[model samples]
Target: MGSNSHPAALYQLRIVTRILALVILLLVLVGFLLPTEYRVERSVSINAPLDVVSENMLSGQNLSQWMHVQGGRVESFDGVLQNDDSIRLLYDESDEIGELTLLEHTGNIIRFDVRPKLSTGLVHNRITLEDHASVTEVKWTIEGDLSVGLLSPYLAFFANDIAGQNFEVSLLNLKQQIESQN
Candidate 1:
């Protein structure tokens, strides 16, 4: 090279830096512009007998005692368990009321589909039991997805963390409730 002035090189470097910064900004914008889908799954285990714990979950009336909600009331029932089954009810989370439906019911497993407040899709909850010697492991798992959009990824991440904690807390509360009954 001939003779590059100090100021000339400095100006060139500044221009290059500005272009690089613009490219990075564009990349970030594009990253957010891309569509994304999110799914969250959370579970917790409680120590109890499989039959007893599973029976408790199947009893729809007992849901209010352990679940995260403002309150829950049984609407109507037409099942063998009488008051144990609820036809309709609301699980209140702040101002959000989750409409729940009893999807499937078996001996040791109960599945409930929840339509969250104003969100799209339904969250499926499966409660099952596995015996461990004197104690049965009661496992409650929630699996669902959020609507896709720019905020979907962020919402998904937050929902995963919050929903996981919610299940953990519910399990802890359930453990206390069941144990206290003894």
Candidate 2:
């Protein structure tokens, strides 16, 4: 009876492992079929003027106040690479962890290439400012491609929720800071 029970348990274990392997393979295949391109947008209305909001976006000063970072990774701007239209943040003073460059600035629309190097691909962010009756509406639209990788599409699939929530928190912080100043 003991011998028979041992063989049956081993057989069940093999069957369970085989089923787990098939499930993992299916998940990998599905990830490959998912889209690699992702876009995330978030907006907030600040009770400040258009110029005030635009200045805050363009200032490139005290970025740690409004820029969100999870996991306690702190990066400071490189003074040499910083200009009115561009800001580069680095680690250990030379290793670039993030960069934001003004791609274009039209009448009411401003575009910036925001690459934080936390992951693969270049992230493009567009900021649109509109003057409301008493408040200014600010919109941020970000887009990027995760490129070709087994897990990249899976990351892209969850990018909206992952990055969008971070952006939402950042926008809220910015709104509070801007509103308090006025």
lDDT of 1 at 3: 62
Residue-by-residue lDDT tens digits, candidate 1, 77-177: 33233323324445433444456667666776677776655455777778776777647676677776666655665666576676777677777878887
Model 1: lDDT of residue 23? 100
Stretches off by above 4 angstroms in model 1 are 1-45, 70-96
Residue pairs whose backbone atoms clash in candidate 2: none
TM-score of every model versus the real structure: 0.65, 0.84
Model 1's alpha-carbon lDDT is: 0.63
- Candidate 1 RMSD computed on C-alpha atoms after optimal superposition onto the true structure: 6.8
Candidate maximizing TM-score: 2
lDDT by residue (1-182, candidate 2, tens digit) is 78999989999999999999999999999987888999998999999988777777544443556767553223444332223355554545444466666777765788778667545457888879999976999898999998756888988999999999988988898899899888
Question: Which ranges of candidate 2 are over 4 A from the true structure?
Answer: 62-64, 71-85, 91-96
